[model samples]
Target: MSDLITVEIPLGERSYNVVIGPEALMTVSPLVAEMMQRGRAIIVTDEIVAQHHLAGVKTLLTAQGLTVETITMPPGETSKSFAGLEGVVSRLLDLNVDRNETIIALGGGVIGDLAGFAAAVTKRGVNFIQIPTTLLSQVDSSVGGKTGINTGHGKNFVGAFHQPRMVVADLGLLTTLPDRELLSGYAEIVKAALIDDARLFDSLEKIGVQVFDSRALSQAIAAAVAFKARIVAEDEQERGRRALLNLGHTFGHAFEAEAPKDVIRHGEAVAAGMALAFEYSVQLGVCPAEDAARVIAHLDDIGLPSEAGKLAHTQWDARRLVARMRDDKKNQDGRITLILARGIGNAYIETNVDEEDLVAFLETKLK
Candidate 1:
């Protein structure tokens, strides 16, 4: 059995555990088998991961004596879309997957969100397991149960809070991530460290090891996932504590809005977003200037963007991009709430930003 970290998400009957460990993918049979009221299961992955890892996952499940089917979307953030999700769901129905069946999302965050959304809406609900193959999904997106697809209006505009039955993070997968992709995932851990875990940040800064060390990678994954599990369990519905998880997301999403879609990945935007939020925090007096500099310095140290600023694609569909932030599952009221850092290990919501400030922020950073 994989070493499991159970998160008692307060969604009552919808609660689930997030398992972390070596060879966790093989445990799918018993882990999911116990959760299913039906015998059929479907694996949804992006074509890239499908070509690389789908066979391993499929073989593992089959060896466990579980029946499996696999479907894939192309690689990239854009795949988190209505059309992409429709393809998966359509395939699910065609495969005769039922409400009691399970969906095993075996890729990065994009596939997790798309497949989880399919599970959430399929016959009202279905079990979903997160087999996050990338470092970012292992520690961030895969744990929260927030699933959705992007709209032309913005990113992740359509989705649900459907928790997965289990999450498997294979350190072996991290070994295959590109150097840039690895750094991208590190940005999220950096954001977590800046917000509420200075000790973790300090450790990563002082002793962060490359993926070659299985022990180090496992420790990093466990630590980050444990932190997220605690936050999600406290506020599974994003009513409070969970919002802390968005520390760099606001600025990150905006940076994403200005990008040439896929030219920069989600983690890259998050890296830039962390810097922007830290800058905004210092400017607003919410955080100290020294702290802001430290935040930027750390991201830079990890090869993430500290001053990625923003791209000024004059024709950039700003309104279309900004629209996503407003509707993002993280927003509240008409004002999009942001998790801004006050200092390392301290972050809070700032809803006082006005349109003028936003425009200036966007123009200065994005343009």
Candidate 2:
């Protein structure tokens, strides 16, 4: 095990620590013990993660004299929906969980979102801990308090900014993830660098495929987490600069909405969406064409989905994807909001984007 890295999200009253490294799960028991009032905790996870890490977590908490209950759901994007939220909340209520108790999210992004949202609304609100077992969850979903289930209209359209009391990202758990999953998560890491960290982007470009190497992986995760912590602290409610974090999400979510469940993972969509964002920026003369090409080349080299037409299992329509973007939460006054880059490591929020122009650009990509 390597030395653990702790990144602080300084949100004053809501501030918390995100601990990352191999075997960081060891920190969870003591942290949960401190938050226990009734000495009870509920673990919400998907079946896939439960099979691998659930029993060990239960043993750790029970050793500390805490009563632990678990709610396990199916594994996949479909589980992040109204039905999933209802099932978790209902189970927690049935177990008589109280505000003083804690809810632990123990899986990837889907489990984190579902369980975190459950913690937000149940008993009006309760403290929860994030034990993210996947690379995507460890670097992205687990650190931020943004939690919610998906609606038929779009992804994350119904969610809240409920920060976790603690986030334990055990890198050892990531060793079990498939290569495709690792690649998917790496897209977000690239996104953070593209948003405002040119140095980080440069490092990523040099490291390239070696990012999966342990030391490199740890360093990348720490840098990405630190970047997000700073942005989130400044704009917890996303009133300003924080919107930069959604560099690829607006286009990503639309891809997700049009695709069938589990056909495309969130990170895969973001990878393609990011490529499109840069390409669109180039078309609008806002970003250099060379920068857009570089972004696409990096994504393709990483085996990620870098173009909408290249995304497997779904045939995309430019008009339908544009319609989905209209429902994005970031939009205001019926004008679409997009994150565009002027260059690598320079992304900004662009509002009132011309829909006709967007459709035309997407049409080109489809062809």
Candidate 3:
């Protein structure tokens, strides 16, 4: 028997299920049918995913009598753009994708964010299902209601809080992921563990990067999703506890925006960002220096970048990077909101980040 797990995001009426496992994709059609009685679906995927899973997705939905149409975009971070959003919106309109029908985001985080934002704005909003293929999307982006695109200013700078009707994360699909991409996804699982679950972090340390083993992978994914499910249920709009999910994101996003687009992927930046967050916490006299070192060592053991200097195509400019963080959505009244840690598995939101201190910390990392 296959190991299948489902985590429910208890959001009253807007609540949904994150179904994980090898057979998770099979559940998408029925879930979409329940959400959209018309049995119509327009799949939004990238060219790469289309080559791999688009046909199977069509077959699944078609078996359920759902009329399926697909729109393919070029794969990469560049696809998360105003132009990409506009293109998706236009295609849905052309296909007569009414509000009652559904949009299935059938790729990684990029597809989920772009397609989800399209579903949010089109005809005022439409039902959508998330079929996140990559491990990063599976454990993090797909579960949250965060849907957005990037602008020249920064990553995920433009977007919405629209949740999906269902999230189908087929772990089997991850078997085909490139090793680099797979490690990138592992960074999110590590983030989740560091944010709230010390036990999880301990298990990961013991397991090393062999987390791809069937039992280990399933457990890690379930644990990560469960952690996120609880946080999202408590603070759907990122009002409080939810912000903890962005522990490394604030610094990570700044670096990501400054680095070359095609280079460091989101999770890679996050790995570096997380290390920076821990190191910065030590500088703030918050997290223990030993804790920060432990976290960095684990990330390095897994082949993830633990330092900003290691990132490719990065300009390593502290001032410009800090400028990018100023545009982060978490900021309020010009104060940078950061997710810091007291130690491993104990992250919190700190809104009053001192700019001078932050710049100094970044300066050390730049060179």
Residue 285 displacement (Å), model 3: 1.2
The runs of at least 3 residues in candidate 2 whose Cα sits more than 4 Å from the true structure, single-residue gaps closed, are none
Worst 10 residues of 2 by lDDT: 25-34
- Give the poorly placed runs of model 1, Cα more than 4 Å off: 1-13, 27-29, 33-38, 209-212, 309-333, 358-367
Q: Write the per-residue lDDT of candidate 1 for residues 1-367, one digit (tens) a residue.
A: 5353333334467666665656666654566665555655678888889878877777777666677777878898767888887888889889877777777898998889999999999778888888899888988999889999988777777789888877777766666788888877877777777778989887887874463366666677777777787788788878887888887787677667766756776787787777878887777777889888877777766677676543222244335445556765566678877778778888887765665565566566545
- Name the weakest run of 10 consecutive residues (lDDT summed) in model 3: 27-36
Clash list (residue pairs), candidate 2: none
As for candidate 1, its clashing pairs are 154-324, 310-365
Which stretches of model 3 miss by more than 4 angstroms?
27-29, 33-36
The sequence of per-residue lDDT tens digits that candidate 3 reaches over residues 1-367 is 2577888988999988888887777755576666655667788999999998888878888888888788999998778999999999999999887777767899999999999999999999998889899999999998879999987776787888999988888877787799999988999999999999999999999999788887788889989999999999898888778989997898888877777656887888899999999999999999999999999999989988999976765578888878878898889999888899999999988989988889988898878
- Estimate every model's Cα lDDT from 0 to 1: 0.75, 0.88, 0.87
Candidate 2 TM-score versus the reference = 0.96
| Cα lDDT for residue 52, candidate 2 | 89
Enumerate clash totals for all models, in the order shown.
Answer: 2, 0, 0
Specify the poorest-scoring 10-residue window by lDDT in model 1. 309-318
Higher-ranked by TM-score: 1 or 3: 3
User: lDDT ranking from best to worst?
Assistant: 2, 3, 1
Residue pairs with clashing backbones, model 3:
none
TM-score of 1: 0.88
Q: Estimate each model's TM-score.
A: 0.88, 0.96, 0.95
